[model samples]
Target: MEWLDERKMDRGKKPGKLLGNKNSKNHMDLQDIIRESALPFLPAKSLRRFTGVCREWKLQISTPFFAHNQSYSFRDVSGFFCQSPSGALSFVSLNQMAYGVPDPSLKFLPEPVDIRCSSNGLLCCQGRTGYRAYYICNPVTQKWKKLPETTANHGTDPAVVLVFEPSLLNFVAEYKLVVSFASDLDGYEFEIYSSIDGSWRISAEISFGKMKLLPRTGVHVNGVVYWSSSMGRIFSFDLSCERSTIINNIGSSSLGAVNGKLHTACLLGSKLSVSELSNAYTNTMQMNSSAKQWQVKHAVTLNFSVPDLYPRSYDKETVLFLGGDVVVIRHEKKLISYNMKTKEFTEVITEEDTYSRMVPYVNSLVEI
Candidate 1:
């Protein structure tokens, strides 16, 4: 996370108090009031502008406390990033679409790259310019940093996931990039790159024996990362504990984070079954406890079948995101949402046939 070292300097030097009287008590009180009441509500774009309003505003917004509080406070799904097979990228505002407001297409990233995953507000992407080089970028801020290429060669199936913990840094940006790939001789390997160290190295290796790994299907939930194997086994890696465990009996399913807990959904017979971990703790001891089990939250059986979708599609559906009670599922060209409470499915309309990949998007001021 040395990319964030500059933020430490920013935090230490308080911009010389550009906005108010340096010696006046009333002006200091006014700044404090505005910082608490007004700043958090502003959009990331407006917040960036406010950073230029004065040294005080910039320092206030850059504080880790302010960033963390504002991030959790504004958890609304503001928009989504849509990509096309032709390589064009766009941002669709959910707020605008729901209100029948016409929105001009917005460019998502500075480069038209394939976005692998999103955490916090930043996206981990693969651009054409970087060979085996990954990019961590904030689409909202248009700020990006190309990550150092890993030492391992994964061939084609590199299981990559981005884990961004905004609370880790008090006054700067920080994130961890975890990559799992198979070598020609070594089988499966996991590597982690920390912004603090600014380098990548192998962390651990999984002895899957003869089992095959499902590529590009890793999900992070509650500080744990889950990846599926071909034999219906899910590999659970405790990021904090640096240990891996094999979960038995779960069939092909899409994994997602629902309310910061791990959730899995797969089709069983005619029903769409969704289940979540009973507890939120990711520690190995707690997860391995006998009391902790996956609790089925909702199961909805559809009366009709979607043509051209096989039974396996139930588990194969690309889970765009899971937030609150709504879970977004993408199957081929269509994107749909399922409500946990009502058990109703609704189609999310978008630019028809233009979407190749879609991920849940939130606006944030985090920059590299």
Candidate 2:
């Protein structure tokens, strides 16, 4: 170590002899103190200020040790509830459910938005109704991954609605952030997003008119992400292929296509099937049917007659039925959950105070 300045290190007249030479221990102590004081899990806000301290601190903050979202969950239906301008987002964790880790992708979200998933232990959130705001955040480690700044597409209403494609037999783990946006530009084009190479890029875009009944409720089947569009069309984003394919109209209007298609997702046997615009949600449309269209199966009538579920209200034409153990929904007034196994529908639960009063309105519930 370099010798201390002679004058400053004068030991003989010491008011406490020359202070021992600065060492790595002292350096590390300061880092430890700062980390312990400020919450590192939430980096969206604290990041700028934290890194502003110094270069060494910046490098240290970049490490995984300081960034993560804490796994704060609700034990039951009332365990934890998220609030959106529209309504609540609630989940009933099965006894078998396991929360791995809560990782923060961003320090602070621009505003309070929706929490799509904390899957694989990472919290994926987006802006509230009508705006395009989203970030990949881990609450535990507090490291925030990035995406191109998100904004709402004019035609599409709510900004970012996405899901993760978990690992399967032939595939590895990958997360997809799906956002519905209608560019104000020509074609008044409506497209969906798939976060590619750390950026939101257009996966599929189509000409969707005023009828905005498409269900952004995408479900992961095998390695594909299937979602319903505004006009009752079902589209699938295949990770393996990196392309979105229109899975022939299952039904014309279950989700919101005034033509009678519906919006919603359901799990059927091995294949993830959605309810058609027809009366029988269990039925699957016969692709390329000349006259006879969809045929109803007896597999599941999951949400056959339920309207007010999750975000809160759906009309006969604006809802999609899911035939599964549990069918979660967004209604016009609140968030509700239906248990097919139990044949029951839950009461209205609000995530935040705002959405509880806003009321979720369904444009169409035609089984698409």
Candidate 3:
């Protein structure tokens, strides 16, 4: 009778154990399905809230794999980060007035700094606390880290560009920062900082012959930093190879990256001409020692008359940014964008005050 009772209890426990295992497996499957389906569609700002749902969600969102996958949805020009003369920060979305999406309320930066460049959702701000103070931050996350002082001495303000690419590597995520400037001796110099190696080093080709980097005109595309020069040249420094090469010959031009290609904006006999730099450095297998010029795919002339404020004809208006066919410029007291296709100019007003400097901004969840 005792043996019969033991067998009965064992039989009852086996069915319960099997049922529990099946339910646990189904729950894990559901979790994986949810993680895979929702992660791609969610905007970067939503990632923080979803991370708190569970420990699994927290681990998945924090992984570099998730960051890389989510980056694909970030290329759209969501908004513009505007900083006025008074050092007040405001973000204006392109679809703000139309779509009614609430403006992102990011934490204020500790100090006022000119947002110099942005790459892969990280912005590089040039602080006013002397020339050495620079901050790299994700504006959406409002997390910032100050950069190390540059090793090379720059007489003028350096053209700083940050290059960040999210990857699956958890340890020592690599970030490349290039600072191109005219050296004290009146020649071009490139000082680079690497997050993986954790130090700043000047480029191997230190003294670029007779070419000085133009102040406040630097743009990065596809892991290379390009700056217009004083000697009618557009030179590029490849962050991976740490080599410098001249790509175009645009004399004292303002440069911007549009559609992943370099565009030069220069005064073409009183009208601002937009020229796309195409087919510049394709042949890397067999090198051509001759100085290669960037082929202008097409050019568009803008109705940019000389503002009455500036008296000289040679006084070129600064091109703030170039987005697709639209060119944003500061003329007199107005911030306007000239459409290349339509040849129409529209005023871009943020609040009542005119924005001094404008750079293309895209919000993201990049951790500091």
Model 2, range 74-177, lDDT digits (tens) per residue? 11111122334453443322111222122112325455555553333345656654444555654434445545664445332343334442322212224566
Candidate 1 residue pairs that clash: 1-195, 1-196, 1-197, 2-195
Candidate 3, residues 1-368: lDDT per residue as tens digits?
Answer: 99999999999999999999999999998878889766755656567667899998889988866766666445444456766667665666544442112332334556667766677567777667665567777776567777777777754356777777666454223577788766665566788877777778887665547755665467787777887665666778877787788765565456766677778765544467667766675556357656344645445555656543322111243566665666666656556667677777677555634665555665565566
**Across residues 1-368, which tens digit of lDDT does each residue of candidate 1 receive?**
78588887776666556324556777778878888877775556557667888888888988867766666455545556766777666665544432111211224444446766677676787765546577887766566787887787755436777887566334566778887777556456678988889999787556445666665567788788877677776777788877777775346677777778878776544567778877434345644566655788777776544433432422344555665676666654556677786777776667656565565666776657
Could you tell me the lDDT of residue 71 within candidate 3?
Answer: 60
Please list all clashing residue pairs in model 3, or write none if there are none: none
Cα error, residue 8 of model 1, in Å, equals 63
lDDT of 2 at 255: 28
After superposition, candidate 2 runs with Cα above 4 Å error: 1-81, 84-111, 114-122, 127-133, 138-143, 150-163, 168-173, 184-196, 203-216, 223-226, 229-324, 329-368
The order of the candidates by lDDT, greatest first, is: 1, 3, 2
Root-mean-square deviation (CA) per prediction: 13.3, 16.1, 9.1
Which prediction has the highest lDDT against the true structure? 1
Off by over 4 Å in 3: 1-68, 97-112, 168-173, 209-212, 250-254, 258-260, 265-274, 279-318, 323-347, 352-355
